[model samples]
Target: MNVHLGKTPVGLDGIAAAETVLSHVDGQQGELIIAGARVADLAAASGFEGVTARLWSAATTRSISEAEVRASLGLARQRAFARLPELLAATSGLTIVDGFRAGIAALRPEAGLDDEAAIVGACPVIAGALVQRARGSEPVAPDPDTSHAADTLRMVRGDTPDRGEVAALDTYLVTVSDHGMNASTFAARVVASTQADLFAAITAGYCALTGPLHGGAPEPVLEMLNAIGTRDNIRPWVDAALARGERLMGFGHRIYRVRDPRADVLKSAIERLAGGGADLPFASEVEAYIRTALRQKNPDRVLDTNVEFFTAILLDALRIPRQAFTPIFAVARAAGWTAHAREQQRTGRLIRPSSAYIGPRP
Candidate 1:
């Protein structure tokens, strides 16, 4: 049996090709390219709306305006809500992944047809369901006039978010839009390769993210913060965590050799909403202490702060309920899932990986 699958001949890693347009992840150097540009360079030049538009345009021939994205997502939110009661009943007592899978099955599009509008649109719908579930409330209707970010905030909070909160949510979505071939995106591509429809593929991706290793970090990230109780307790908390063998929730990544760029990007957004002065300073102190202690204890696995660290921070700042963090991740990630699904379909090959089959040869 081969220990690792040989590098895929057709799939390009670390290098950019023309099929999909969005950020490219240079895992080795920890760099991201958005629409034929680096994230840092793009950061100084563009806002969330521009990057999202550029990514969507690159994949689809249709020209979908931001207004259209808003309208479609708004519609999807209502549609998803209408289905929620049944979904909630069906998914009772199940794990979130199982429940989400139930929701996906319940919400799967009729017929064999694929609709980009529906696929791009289902993001906030799924997000709304997960958010409402977390809050112990029934799903709410989506507002058509609002932007995707703003409407999501409204749906979750039952009121429109202030400008700062909306801006922060926009930045969060943009920051998480794509991250090379992280676990969930990889799961999405694998399912898409089998020619699964967009919803199925995205459902598979959501399952991957529901695991603790990926999208689950954000919930614990905030818990860690709350456990510290006060600013002064942060260092001791870090020390105690180090003394035990617990890995810090949000402080590392597989691809990023340096810092995760998404962390800094979302941190900027959090600063805007959370008044990034004293709290941010406290966060910085906690991060620094964790880094030093981890390095001292285990030099090889450095475990620097990753995206989840500040993801929790920004979401908390936006007054988003803690339980909904992973669901929000799924919503933002749906865009990339849809885009990738379309890309896989264009390639038109079924994804089939062969196993070694070492058990008792026939």
Candidate 2:
């Protein structure tokens, strides 16, 4: 029964595993479209709540209101807060994302809150709690009245974030909200295709995002910058790292043949936070130096900046620690995961792909 398709795709690259109207990534042109609009345009036009609502409505093929989603998430956060102590205890020895995994796994949907609302709403609560716990600080209560981005920073920093800082965070959350069929989104859809509950699918997505090749690269990007230590060390650092055959953490993308568009979106967001938050001048100087060095090294190839590069700087300026980078990514990407999950359940089949075996013939 040899039923394998054409040459099996390595890592499923170039595979159209699912069709989605939710988002599209045009790697050649470096464009991202979410909910029928360019990501840059959408991210610019809306906050996290608005972007999330748009994605949800597109995926479910219904008109879900942003205010309704926001209110539901607020209610869910209050409920999610009840489990923080237990989550903190259970996840004491784990990384922030691991704590999030435990917390998400523990979620049980209740009356008046659908699973999508429950997971998305509770994500910031869980992420913020883990961040606070990691810092040996008590988690602040969520302000359902405040926007999700502001409340998230509040819980982690134990202080109310100013308007600019809140806006920066909201921009970031919206920028990375959904990214076509990345590994994590695919994982979410795979689980959902199996008819698993939304929580189960989202948990799968969260687990996938913890991998270094995915959401885990931002902190390492910061580590690289810290290693360089100064603007003067930029070229020498690039040469040394390249000579040693180390991949620059945030320079290239597997999908994008050009500069990642999300890079620009986040870079602008960081710049806007320049009055107080992320050091835009230093980061720009470093980026320019590194980009030049990479282009000089690989003239025939296009190795340009990606999202993680500025993500590190932006989050660092916000006073978020290194460990929480991936967790916060999960917090932001939950919107995409839930939307993809619901879409799969509504429109796709159980994601069972066949494998091509090339072992010694029996």
TM-score against native, each model: 0.84, 0.96
Per-residue lDDT of 67-183 in model 2, one digit per residue for the tens? 988898888888788767764566768878788888888887768888888898888888888877777777878988889899889887889889989998999999999999999
Model 1 over residues 1-362: C-alpha lDDT tens digits? 32545555433445332345545776567778766777655545554445556566656655656555555555665555666676566777765445655666556673332354455455566556666666687666777667778877887777767888887788777777766567787778778887777777887888888888888888788788778867789878888887787878888786676788778887777667656222777677778888888788878865778889988888877777666677788767777767776666676466665444435533
Where does candidate 2 stray beyond 4 Å?
A: 1-6, 86-89
Off by more than 4 A, model 1: 1-21, 40-50, 61-64, 82-89, 92-98, 110-114, 133-138, 274-278, 357-362
TM-score of 2: 0.96
Cα RMSD of all models vs. native, in order, equals: 4.1, 2.1
Q: What is the lDDT of residue 275 in candidate 2?
A: 70
Top TM-score model: 2
Q: Give the TM-score of candidate 1.
A: 0.84
